[model samples]
Target: MLDNGNVVWDHSEPRRGANDGTSYLCHGHLARLREIVATTPKAVAWMREQLEPVKGDFEKTAPMKASSKLPISAAAVDAADETLGLLCSWAEYTAESIGQPAPDMSNTWKVLASADSTDGALRVQGMRSDGIATVDSVARWMLERIDVIATHEWVEDFTSELCDQRATNLARWPYEERPKPAKGIECPDCGHTTLVVFTPAFAPKYSTEPLLRNGKPVEVTETVNVYDRVINPGGSVSRSSRLVKRTKRYADGSPVLATVQRLNYAPPLLVQCRSSTCRAVVRESDWARMILQAG
Candidate 1:
């Protein structure tokens, strides 16, 4: 558990007796890259707009003051220009990687990379020099665009690819004895037969409630319950549960009818092999077939 009360999986500890083979792309890594790819172009455009007025001020012989002082300083203008250039280069790189024609960013990348070392400082100067209202608008626009990209449907393709790669690699491991949920299985790295088990503690369930705008029911939203049970080799068990809510809204900001919940149980849990020297984890279905020969 984190200090913020969020439960996070700690994968930092190296697995005992694990293979020191070539590294592979995992789901988390791919998702992060996708976010950067999707948001860079939008961020670049937004930063350019915010810096346009400042650039105009810089070009003038006398710094143009808005109300009391100059709208933007020379340093702030330089920093914004550098940031925009870097973002343009990133956008072009991502476009090419996704099979799209790269944007013309030769001039953008030609700019020196050392113009601004701190993005936060540039933003602060921008906000202080140019009114706070303009800075807030740009900040909100950038955040909304990033949020849309983070939750976009295209992420599923990246996740599927990661899962497929993992399955293929795990298939190459040689097991001493077949794994089973009932009798347990031996660790692939170590010869230990003891393993920690994990199973669904509760059947999945959901409930819907009508959302109201004013006095009328606009739409229905559904909340689902997910539960998991983790059992150690010593028979000690722990459970975790969470409630997830799904909502939909129309373009006018009115709630829409609820959509059917799509339950995803990918990369199903595997028992944690309890060998101090070799803690190998295998897929639940694979272990069951290996031990019970269950179809």
Candidate 2:
């Protein structure tokens, strides 16, 4: 498993690559690489658009009823530029490592290839013999060669680096752009109203009952039952005996005749404190205790 909760492998079996003294990735990881390579170019394009000059007159000429666009600062542009540079560098490095043709340094590529200014006509590793190739084309080539690219560890590293860069760019935006938390809930640690609750969108419920077959209860075993004797005012009553059918036992010693599933109407929620001063969190395991304390 990786930091982003993506599991590269879940079985106990050793990989063939490892056995052969070389590294290899499972089919799933290759597919994941393909997905990342295929979608990253679009994200790069959007980030590039952020580098455009900000509109200066829109704010002043806008009507009072119209909503204004989010403010893009110099720092935001710098961050986007940095992310784009890193992506281009990674693409080039992958090409070099795999013995593929170095990416063609087109005008857009040259501008973003490095943070420093570059001459428009200067090309890196000479022009790609296959003609002009944009970042998207390079990415497509990578997708086609996904199987021979790198090991699982390399894939994980790639995923983390790109994801972290994207996260950094996103964090540059103001908190108002994110989901609005319930302000009425107070943070127990700071005594401030900054508790945010997140609940699972799809909560599952389960039920257990007697296991049935052909519309009848399937008896796993039988047990003998004895009726208790009762003492009368003048005489004693005799005890009675009978047999009782028993169902299979659950793992926890409970009887399970069958099973059913339903939606959990009241699912557990995670409570987090948004206060910078007191970054306390209450996980679902302790949610009940926290609620009791609050009450």
Candidate 3:
């Protein structure tokens, strides 16, 4: 168990086999435990590196001769405390997984709590050296366990099994869901031109009355002439003319009609009000499509 009350795996003993009154090794469980153990050394190294500069800063700012209290930055203290807390949690988790007793980590917790309690208190001393030593001791204890776990006969096999299991699990996981696209438009309530609305693809389609221009529905007409050759015993040519009608645009430039030019569908979108004081997300509704398309 780690000093933080985390139970670590005991590599010295052989595990019991299932329902046979025999002892055998479970490589899978050991592999998982080993993977966790492997990270401790790196974590300890990182904690040392992080604390070095903080320790230096404290030493420079702390009183040299007397036992006078020195002020430390809350940010620095919080950072150290967070690192320690993570280590503690890691230790506790490791211990719990292996069904072993965890160590008493009350001292480490006190160190973390002291940072908050010292705030607004009188005569708060900076125990930088003590904090560093405590971290160092914890790191050393973790290293010892790492050494023991590394000495297992199947450590290499455990590592390989862990890697395979991880790959298998990752392969089985589903891909992330894509986000809906955002549609921008003018807000009705705030009159903000930059209001954006999110339209989800699964949302039901909506209909709105066709927009008008000069109190009339906008339309367009096209005229085309086709020439045809006719050999009536003398080789002559005849021409014909025709007119085609298609909706183009309103006088205000809004599209009068939209054609299904492509079969591919677009993702849903979100639109938000861009007004600084009235930043609101437009709700998904039938009217939202009109606002998006019209704008």
Error of 2 at 225 (Å): 99
Residue-level lDDT tens digits of model 2 in 130-185: 22125445554555555455543575577567767766665654222232465555
- Best candidate, lDDT-wise? 2
Our model 1 lands, by Cα RMSD against the true structure, at: 24.4
lDDT of 3 by residue, 1-295 (tens): 2232222233764433211212122333432333333332223223333322235676567466676444544534554455445545545654565566654454344323344564754432333443543444443344335334334444345445444533442353312222233344457657757554332313223345544577765454444554555556566656555555544657897654422233222222334454544444443474557555777
- Can you list the residue pairs that collide in candidate 1? 179-291
TM-score of each: 0.21, 0.36, 0.23
Two-way lDDT contest, 1 vs 2, winner? 2
Q: Which regions in candidate 1 have their CA more than 4 angstroms from the true location?
A: 1-25, 37-69, 91-100, 104-295
lDDT-better candidate, 1 vs 3: 3
Best by TM-score: 2
Alpha-carbon runs more than 4 Å astray in model 3 = 1-70, 111-133, 147-295
Candidate 2: residue 241 lDDT (0-100):
64
Rank by lDDT (best first): 2, 3, 1
